[model samples]
Target: MNILVISGGPRKHGRTAIAARFIERTYGFHTVDLSIVDMPMYTGEEDQSSNPFVKSLRQSVLDADAVLLLSPEYHSAMSGALKNTLDFLSSTQFLYKSVGLIAMAGGGKGGINCLNNMRTVMRGVYANAIPRQLVLDPSVFDYDRDGLNREAAEQVDGLVEELKMYARIAKEVKEQQLI
Candidate 1:
């Protein structure tokens, strides 16, 4: 399955990216990182007239079978950049897609609020968001080269099993309707 991971931290070496990369590896699956680490900020209308950057970002979201958003808690929620990007991505880009969310914050609460807000947005557009969530506390892990964290790595395997199960059930239910 194709999975797109969006990391919402400005820092390239932060916990959110680390966890996302860990999940990315579990899939042996095709993936893209949508954080500031890669894509430029959204300018949906103007940039769309010429920019390959926005075009490619929109395509990636459309192609993925599942979306994984790894976000940090900013004043108890997701950062503006992440929110703005999604605001622009509503409709055909994100509609009816499966989504998985993970949030990590160093203090106060984890980014659960961020994920929930995102879930509401995704649901508004008819995306099938995965209900299981991962909330990371203290939000940082040691990455031994190659950006892989041991604990996060282990959890990804478990998450994949859930994704696979859901995919199977969804497929069966869909096929039954065709009969």
Candidate 2:
């Protein structure tokens, strides 16, 4: 399956990027690091049809069978950059798509709030976001080795598998026009 992973951290090499890269390395999924891209705030007042970045972002979501959104917890929620990115999309890009969420915290807590916020946004965009989400903290990482601990790694695997399973079901139902 073609899985698109979006690293919603504002820093290119932040914890969210680390987790996205880990998943890419482990499962061979493609990743889009939003920090490197120029994502203008979505005002929805101007015509964005010619904006290449916006088009690419929408196309990426449209092409993926599943998506994973990784964000760093910011003040008990997801970063502004991530929220802005989501604003560029709507049900046209996400409806019926299976999505997975991962929230990272610099400290050893507060990732759950970020996950919950993202889930609510996914629902608004009509994404079939799976319930098996991840809340990661500093303790789960091993920056020296550029990887997560064994337990955390296993949890990531399960989350990815869950996304794939849900994506497959969604695909089948869509193909059969079962809604």
- Give the top-scoring candidate (TM-score): 2
Give candidate 1's whole-model lDDT. Answer: 0.68
lDDT of 2: 0.91
lDDT for each residue of candidate 2 in 55-167, tens digit (9 for 90 to 100):
99899999999999999999889989999999999999999899999999866566998999999999999999898999888889989877899999999999998999999
TM-scores of all predicted structures: 0.79, 0.95
Which tens-of-lDDT digit does each residue in 1-179 have in candidate 1?
A: 66677776656677776766666665665544545434555666665535566667678888776777777878877766677667657668775577777777667775678778777877887777787777776534655654445665566566666666665566567679899
Q: Please list all clashing residue pairs in model 1, or write none if there are none.
A: none
Model 2 segments beyond 4 Å from truth?
none
Cα lDDT listed for each candidate: 0.68, 0.91
The deviation in Å at residue 130 for candidate 1 is 1.2
